[model samples]
Target: SGGLHGVGASVVNALSEFFLARSWRDGYEWTQEFSRGKPKSGLKKGKPTRTHGTMITFRPDPDVFSKTHFSYKTILAVSESKAFLNKGLKITVENKRDGEKPVTFRYNNGIQDYISRIVQGTTLVNQEPFYFEKEDDFKIECVVHWTIATDTEMHSYANSINTSDGGTHELAMKAGLTKAVRTYAERRNLIPKNIKSISPEDVYEGLYGIISVLVKNPQFQGQTKEKLNNPEINSPIDTAVKNACEAYLLANPTMADAVVKRVLLAAEARLASRAAKETVTRKLSSLKMNLPGKLADCSSNKVEDSELFIVEGDSAGGSAKMARDRKTQAVLALRGKILNVEQVASLEKIQTNNEIKNLLATLGCGVDQHFDLSKLRYGRVILMTDADVDGAHISVLLLTFIYRYMPGLISHGHIFLAMPPLYKIAAGKETFYAMDEMEKEKILAKLNGRKFDVGRFKGLGEMSPDILKETTMSPKTRTLMKVQVVDHKATGKVFERLMGKDPKARFVFIKERAEFAELDI
Candidate 1:
């Protein structure tokens, strides 16, 4: 179903070797079959049904793809998103391959429901979202709400197609919201006269918004059609969103004031952080640039071709460096666990920590407002820790650091957690490795009748250089669990509940996820 323009049906038909389609309409039912996009049979009559609809079944050609596996999650995401964008449309997605659990999605409330679903965990300034629509040369509609969450999330669509690289419409929406909120704050005398004017980043810090537009003859910037190039619709969209948001705020003073306070607080924090960064910058012993002395830097300079392994301890670091591909793989050894970034109060304090400083500098991206993903030195930033509870804690601490300050690294699929073998089994000259208890059991069963010895790896340092290279350091053979953001808001909430200062929240979170936990001696 992923195709360009109206080619969805034809594209699916062309790629599928065996295709079947049925249509029930006009007091008659018709069916057809195709083999490789060619008609195997013409219109065949079928028994009449109560409803009129079309159903299609397809199996993509095996030759077209090296692997034929499909992602149920991807299918479900498309169905759910479509159901939300098209009000009153019912979409039922089923995974027939895996016990076929069907989920029905019908969003009569449209983007309002989507907004509510996205902000379920966050504290909202307004319980009910503000929705607006306008029709003229272009049909524009949007829904917006502010959350207690720090990051601003914006989703944009043109003709129901997601525009990940937002263009003029998104810019217009931001400008409108910022201007309206700033004006309201000023009129209410919420800001002290000494404070500088509010910034767009401040007003948008906690914004959760979606902008959907129906356009005619859309001009796109690239092959992906990620951004809209048409400039004519910007003014109209800006006017519509601004007027609607302004009107809603005037009608609800409490909500408006609360929103203003949230933005003002964000602005204050930004200023404080910037001032602290300046101080920290001055405090550095030297401005001379160099990789951390402990880091075994890779020869490759291209970001896409390089990987950095943040190993747990000096022993593991030495092993990883010896096993690593010197051409592209770099290793940095941390003494112990990184500082809990959530508990750290100031940017200067974070900068002062040697290990944290090395990480920031090695990435070639500063934390907070100074972070530039384009200047990042590594394509993959992997956490190569031991397979233990402490290792897990270290990973969480590192994740917290990235999520809090340089979130772009995670969202862009650059962060990963390395998977090292947990056990090594040798049967005479034949040696086998296992990643988990299940894998170990399988390997033991495979060498059932033969004499074998089992060796459990307590840490990466325990593995010989050759074994480490084969199991964890080699890009071709290593198993790396990518750290990605599937649901930004949900992920943020989980991070807050697990790593923030709220012990009660953390306990509740642990309890919820521990339902399937089993105690091990």
Candidate 2:
């Protein structure tokens, strides 16, 4: 139960036909070769090098594995996670056979760098990051920050391996944060004198932080290193963070004041939002309005059999409403773009928006932490937008909303993106749909130079209802890709780069990936 590097390399070596591990330690380099968990050669001298680290190369034995190759994304994700957790440690990846240039990643700011990357563009309570490190019998370092994004992003590690299923360290950190914030608020009279309580969940909204612990004996709960079972690590971290945060607050009175004010404002908004939701719930309970005016709901009472198509624009919505299976598919037409929930607090304001209000009323499920999955009317939430850049942006905005407010949607596998064809190729009525440029080329190659007519789908509005149903709306024929947050940190980095206010990051991202873009002309 070592760290990720040790565990991953061990597993790879155990399953490999031939494994070569080179280590540089104590001012010398050494190598070890293994086969099927048995060493082929003892420790041998390697070439002298200035660097001090280990390099493991292993080829999985075909006989041992159903698939011998490792996923590039998976490996890259692991490396990225390491870089994130370790901060200043330099990590690089290269494919030797392909002669690909090595990609180097290093972050001096640690989790603050992560927070800045994740909550880009969104307004923030404070520009400067809060950082603390404490070492005792149990060593721990924590970084905490908040962004304008109305979601919490946290990652915890024990001895450098990610604990996806957090352990005592995470629990302690949460407890510490809750206590520190509550005590500060009460001392400052931020909360009402009558109310004596505040929950951890309440304090964490719009917060992003990372906690890393190093212990000599780490008790992992599973083979995946998802949880830590070390009981001793909790109190040390709790005390350390409590002391550190208190000192930080006192030292940086201005920053602390701003944070407390923000939290107090959020608390007030939360109360108002709760009241609004109760009103909505009471109205629904009375059966005063069974459905929203804009929604063309499905007939099915069973949630599993029902699907909701969130269409952008009135024209696409009309087409979807007509093309939809009236018994199983519901359509909610969005009049215009909704507020970017990423940068907003109190989703109750979102509920005031006509489109969002209609959606909430139709679905009968609340938003944010108040959202009840059981109350949802649809099993599938499909984002059906035009096949253009604007449509893509709208879809992303919607995704950001869902990802922030109703993470359970993605976690439970209910979220999807509808893939409508970009080009409709027809050769004398022999029609074929090309989803992208690669598909268009493949279809052309299949035709063997035969003259064919091609029609580019400008948007969902341009397609007839029947064509929309066949190519994009119908469950039996449509291509729906389920949205997943496999690597939360990596996804956070991507969002920060693309949506963050930093002009330099967005420019670099666009320029680097420009070659992959396909021109519509």
Candidate 3:
């Protein structure tokens, strides 16, 4: 695994305190043992077995690495990538730590199967992924598809080495595909002469593509081989891909039409977004820009020190404003439930929404390719809602927006949720704010028969400004759950099912998980 990981066979051996290698070939067995990279025993005879494969086992030296444990998921993922790159290759992964059954991945169709596997749960424009491979001069292989979801993913490789920060090879692939699609669409009279030609950005919207390039003398950007910079390799690969795509579309009219339609939609959105961005920029320049009137201003000019809270209502916003440090904390209250962006079709419509527009203006980070975290006004953006059914719904809606559009916010660890108390218990001039029933019960037990005044807050509006400051707004006392996306596909699937347009899927999801849901009232 080159760019895939930092580990290697010799490196592993050198860092291992104990190592063993066993090989069974041609009905004979051979074994060697090592300790701390030094061979303890020469090749020796071992028990014969039917299998003719080699096995290496090693225990890492504690002196070498801070952590000695292995990750099953990481191993499996690398193995899967290998199997995908090499057609007709079979790889089996096993993790004995958790007593789980072993799993094998064998792909006869190579990257096409890889694409199919990746897009299994997501809605596909076509059941089969678009694929092309050429072995002469320079080997170039590619598999691509469009998903119903918004995110676009690209993975490139050079001689089986995963180029995470792809270079010229990936660029060629993108250019080739864009040209091929535009050529086909123009020939098919799909686009009007008045409209602008489809650019790579437009074509890549909702696209999922995987590529691997093999060259005799591959030039890499660095010692780690994070990217391929071979100049000679681009044209040949591009021509091959372009030819393959042209032939594919000519052969499959239905799929070609579907692909063209998706590309056209992407083009429309891109144009619409450009216009909206221009308008927003002009407004901001004029200093008469539209932001949420309810948003309380922060005195701080430093980006790192500022924080923004998207509260549920005006009542909470007012309290939060009074409770906030003023120099750092800003608050913006929602007018009502926001449009579930997952269900929205047009990017223009979403931009036109007052709530979303205000957020974009205030945050200074645009969506999609236009987004820049450096321009973000606040270091932290927290969602503050009540601890009830409506609050939960609002939270999910806001989370969906952030997850789909400003995914980088979560990735950079800037998104958070403020945990305000649900109950206030007062007894003999002493008061405690409880987040849930468990805390309330504990407080009650402590008070015993002291006769305390117990009040359950229906929403954040019920809390006084001082109480709000003490329990939720103050950085010293507040409990903020920092949101993170550990798994993209799993998280995307959840948001899709919950916020997507498909009611049947939502019904099934609710039906399956209904028992675990707690009712507040």
Candidate 4:
């Protein structure tokens, strides 16, 4: 399969302000230069050389691009993917801007090496990855490995180009693998009698696979080459992969049994998760008029006009309730530190926690996979905590829970953090609110030695109802930071290191960034 219809190089040259092309062939070096698609210099012979290769370098035209900078990580990932797709191919990437060391990516065993790298520390159901390659009218190569993880990770390629949206090839792969696993399990009587059947999702729960196909002419959905559109290749690829997987499973009974057992476990979890979700849904449905007992609900029934503030304690909750607009704003005061959802083993376990259940009920949006954005009760969910280290910790914990379960809250611009003042300064009867020490100092500096009184707030509970309404609760004067997820992969790693069960991970993380940390103590 080919991409860009042979216009890739020409397009790059056209978009580049400065372009240089060098070629070594016929025992001589030839060079050419171009600027904005127009030739600056004709092809010229430099010197006789033994090497025979082409090299092109170009700088993106600043006028054509708003931002001309390239991300090193993205480039490295694309380079590594190319190396993995073509076995024994070596790709080197160098970043001169940061003086970072150049890195080389080479995978001798191709996708098998990819699976090995991905599952390096992960527990595996299959010790060895199953690999098959067919070089014919359409070259097809695939590798699959099963792990103890709960999700599937698969990469599909069409002619070495990444196909992120998938299409016929990916569909074929899933069907083939599911068929192979189901047949093997049935033949060996590995599946339990009580369990009805194993689904495709069950078979792929812990599976990691890579599928690469090279067709003479491939049909892509768009210019991005995100999906394959060919219908004829599906049946042949499915049959080939199914036969290959069947033979491998028959040859290795131990691995086959392990795979089947993992699938069965996933199937069981699916049933249990479904039941748990149903129970939660039924219970929540019965509580239309019975919102959380502690919640002080707003008078308005219109979702868009309403807001909910999740306060830290009863003291703060009381202050917020007294300060809020009765028609638009509601308050829910959590008694203590809510459950640390990162440590919870399952969704069912999370549902069992009283505080979490109350919080979920208050939101009116179901948790986890059952979450519905349309069912959300409030237009905005504001976390109004104290301006201190403990408050920050509580906010992080709450964010972890929301990110894991109701990600739509953050992604859809519904989640926000209330920026309450830490210090209130009165200079000659003119009052000023400061969010932190820096703001307080700036305020003092501007006072210019005038007689003033500075009051430091211990927490939101310490602030008066009138002051809270004026500075923190009123939409006209208050500052709220919208929660957003910029890089979800990095965010997940941070959450795992800080809130995950392993204390050592937190220690290591703190140690690594200790120099940059500003300890309040």
lDDT winner:
4
Name every residue pair that clashes in candidate 2.
120-500, 121-500, 121-501
* Candidate 3 Cα deviation (angstroms), residue 112: 1.8
Instruction: Give per-model TM-scores.
Output: 0.75, 0.60, 0.59, 0.62
- Cα-lDDT of candidate 4: 0.88
Query: What is candidate 3's lDDT per residue for 271-296, written digit by digit as tens?
Result: 77788788867766674355668788
Mark the 10 consecutive residues where model 1 has the least summed lDDT.
Answer: 280-289
Misplaced by over 4 Å in model 2 are 1-81, 93-103, 112-140, 146-169, 181-192, 213-240, 243-289, 292-306, 312-355, 368-374, 386-414, 424-432, 450-478, 482-521
Please tell me which model should have the higher lDDT, number 2 or number 4: 4
Tens digits of per-residue lDDT, candidate 1, 142-233, equal 99999888777898888887776789889998888888888888888898665689999998898999988889988767655668888998
| Winner by TM-score | 1
Ranking by TM-score: 1, 4, 2, 3
Estimate every model's Cα lDDT from 0 to 1.
0.83, 0.78, 0.84, 0.88
Weakest ten-residue segment in model 4 by summed lDDT: 62-71
Clashing pairs in 4: 1-215
Clash pairs detected, candidate 1: none
Candidate scoring better on lDDT of 2 and 3: 3
Kindly list the per-residue Cα lDDT of model 2 for residues 1-521, writing each as its tens digit.
25453477667778889999888987779998999778999999867777787778777786654223445677777787678767798988886756778888798867667666765666777667668887778778887886656677777889888786688999898788778877887777777753456767666777777888989888888676778889887787777788778777777778887877766666666766777778766765785365766788889988998999998878888888989999999998888787676555677677677766776667666677667888888999899988778788889878877776777778667888998888899987688887777777777888988899888998888899999999998888878878877676567678767766677998999999999787765
Q: Tell me the TM-score of model 4.
A: 0.62
